[model samples]
Target chain A: MKAIFNKKITFVIIGLLGMVLAVTVSGCKVNEAISSKTGAQLWGENCRRCHNAPDPNTFSPEQWKTVGMHMQTRALITNVERDKIVAFLQQ
Target chain B: MKQYITIITIALLTSTFAKAQTKDTIEVQKIGDKYYVIVDHPKVDTTKQFAPAPAPPPTISKTFDSHFMVVGLATIGFLNTWSVNKVNTPTGVVSTKLPTTNSFGDVAHYEFSPMFLWRHSDNILVEFEPSFSNGSLGVNWADITYFAYPGVILRAGYIVLPFGTYNKRLAAGWICKLPTDPVSITSSPVGSDWGIELEGGQQTGKMKVNYDVALTNGFTLSATDGSIANPDVNAVDNNLGKTVTGRFGWLPALNSGVEIGASGLWGKAGDANTAYKNVSTAMGALDFQWVYAKKPVAINIKAEADMQYVTNASYSNPNPPTVSDTTYTYKNLSYGYYGMFSIRPIVADKFFRNVEFAVRYSSYQSPKGSAFENRQDQISAGVCYWINWRTVFKIGYENLITTNPDNNELAITNLKNTQNILYVQFSVQF
Candidate 1:
């Protein structure tokens, strides 16, 4: 019975992996859309996904630059998004 | 006499002009009653190195604009608990009440975890966090990452495992909606470990994909040769085989605010030479998250479930009723899951906008044959007021129930234990 259940789990895992591969392959053919967005739009949408949206005045441009880089690593945001958010915060 | 005087004056003037050309000169400019001194540097035929080092820079740290930052979180809270026990009697069931126990750390207590980060370069970042909770201190995570490209990264050192959403992303005090974690998430945790990981995310047209793969020193058996327990983290690998774990996540479209992820781990979890040496373990998890932030209200929802399977193995009991029955064997399997929801009103009033409410349900189970066989169910609800983006005050209550399998005679195994707790806490990230 355990072996049978393991096989089912294996199939589910393989299915998920197939989906991941499909996304990876499809992403290569289309234009990256996140680059076309405005800094304000990125700032509003991305920050709220995890915690509250931050006040722009909370940090200086220098600090916001670091914060943007940190979020790129922490939240898995793209470099373009980080730069745009930093630019918006600095503005 | 006129000719002689003219010659003598011309010669004297020529001598004075020659004297002024060779010597140093100083000029002072006055602006608003303040004099600025200017010293003219004489033409020279020499050069000098002001900050002389090895001819070429030796280390990368010398030329980069790096930053050393300290960020942390602190929470202080109070908790009150009530417990009840039940026992089997000759004729019927008997109920007993214990004194209400007041504690500090069971639900919420004083906790401080500070992260130290070093931005070594534009592409490399090193981070470590030391945590102090209740009365003990431990290092939460320490790791270094190199962003090799836009969507690929290399990481090493004590890295957080890519199992579930909470431990990697939402375990911070400022982010978690409630005062305590779901009981189910804690029971079957593949938390951070000493490992090397490759992780990254890419926006693929409409769908987004992210993945993390790791190789680590996996769980190990206890040193005391004790039976009936969960595997523990080993700083050093006790066996030749290592654990492999990875998580894959996908979002259907850009700005979807919805993501589904799956994670799996497999490896040997035993010492090199023993009867339990051949024990193998496998684990799998599925997680989902959604966040909606629009006109009238903002809502967040998340869920995660995990299952673990281990090959059957026998263990030496720490204590035996009879010498003949010193070893016991059982099937090893366990599973757990949790679901959480939260909402905040986004209205004109500032006060109401910062107010939020959340609830969670969690359950865990181990089969009858396992040494640590039991079942648990918990429900937690909380209300919070956000002081700022990174600060919050929360009041929460939780009820938990535990049921044990049929047992012979053991001092520790119980029929049932039920507990209810109420707590309030203030948490801030800085």
Candidate 2:
């Protein structure tokens, strides 16, 4: 009985993974164009999807440089884009 | 007689001469720090004037006086600059329902925490986070951190122990899709301690590396059973040797949507007593996080596992071969693991874009040696609505199961083998 229960849980997890993958693939097919917007606008549009948006002026210029570069990798943005975002936050 | 007549004539003449002289415009005037006589009745030119040399612009010598002003200005500059950290407010309510022989419902918990941060400069920051629950107030974590250089930071004061991603990343309600914390962390582990640490992370090549090393007040055994080791959060170190904790991780870049880490803590668990000397405790954990956000779908996955081991424990046995001798050695150990998955189906529709669905599964077991077999498993599923970027409303349903078959006597009547819980929370950070 315990083995059967474990098998059922495994199936449920697999099914959920399949469903998530299907949805993600369909979403990518629908919206193929990459966004070409300002750093501030991109940050608001992207970061807000998962967590709350942080204030731009929360860190200093020096701090923003480091944070922005780190976030670029975390957010999967290009270095140029990270630079623009850092500039916006710094101002 | 001759002198008197002459004096009378001379007085009349003197009066006439004085009046004439006055009409001629003889005048004494002060100019350029000197007195000048001017006769301007077409008899003298007053263009010639005396003037004192202009003093050099007030100058300070290259002595202490000149450098003192420079030092004073610099000191003021340091004091005047400051930064304010983002305010994080996570307040929520949790309710649980037990449907056993003694069926009842209870509002299990309500808590509020406000995070305060003062950034004295780009390199220096101070944080104070206080929590309130059921009219009881407590300090969560308060610390001061200094950024010595890029990828290096030194921190001191009460700090949140860096065990896994849960304590730092998903701790805030607004940052998590579900409103409940994983049972594995809360069941048998330390969350925070008063400590000093060095921590920092940076990208190296295509990977990111982060590390934290700390020394803190260690753990102590439960006074009653000596089985459960508890963190010395609100107390001074009871032993001479301090606890040392550290975590190190290598990630495929933070933006690569994946991160993995390993953390460990070890220290003596006994107080300054000869009998309890050499008693020790050790804890270790592995954690991972993956987030993917794209066109039509967004998914976030997290997992963690923790194991705890305690040295020899002496417990009084209820049933012993020798009735007079009741003390027995028990191997104290426990392990727990949990996984959480959340996804947002970006269906181009306005409503679905702002909604997320998530699920979590957790298991914890502390095998029976003393009293009863304690095994717990929980399943939680929830939905979140993004009011904006920083505010979220979440509701989740949690089903928990436990087994304890030794005795009927329990702390709470409603706490039994099975329980269903409903949790709702509204969180915002700015």
lDDT of each: 0.76, 0.62
Q: Model 2: per-residue lDDT, tens digit, B304-404?
A: 99987766657665555576766666557788999999988878787888898999999987744535347788898988988765567777787877754
Instruction: Kindly report which residue stretches of model 1 are placed more than 4 angstroms away from their true locations once superposed.
Output: A1-22, A30-33, B1-64, B103-108, B223-234, B317-325, B409-413
Q: Which regions in candidate 2 have their CA more than 4 angstroms from the true location?
A: A1-86, B1-108, B318-322, B405-416
Q: Which run of 10 residues does model 1 chain B get worst, by summed lDDT?
A: B45-54
lDDT of 2 at A63: 55
Clash pairs detected, candidate 2 = A27-B296, A52-B389, A73-B255, A74-B254, A74-B255
The residue-by-residue lDDT of candidate 1 on B214-299, one tens digit each, is 88887675433322233333356778877878888877657848888889887677788876676667888899989898879899
Per-residue C-alpha lDDT of model 1 across residues A1-91, encoded as one tens digit per residue = 6476557656755666676667766766545576578898888887877788888988766567666666766667666667788999987
Best model number under DockQ:
1
Chain A TM-score for each of the predictions: 0.69, 0.54
Q: Scoring model 1 with DockQ, what do you get?
A: 0.41
Clashing pairs in 1: none
Q: Each prediction's interface RMSD?
A: 2.9, 13.4
Q: Measured by TM-score, how close is model 2 to the native structure?
A: 0.65
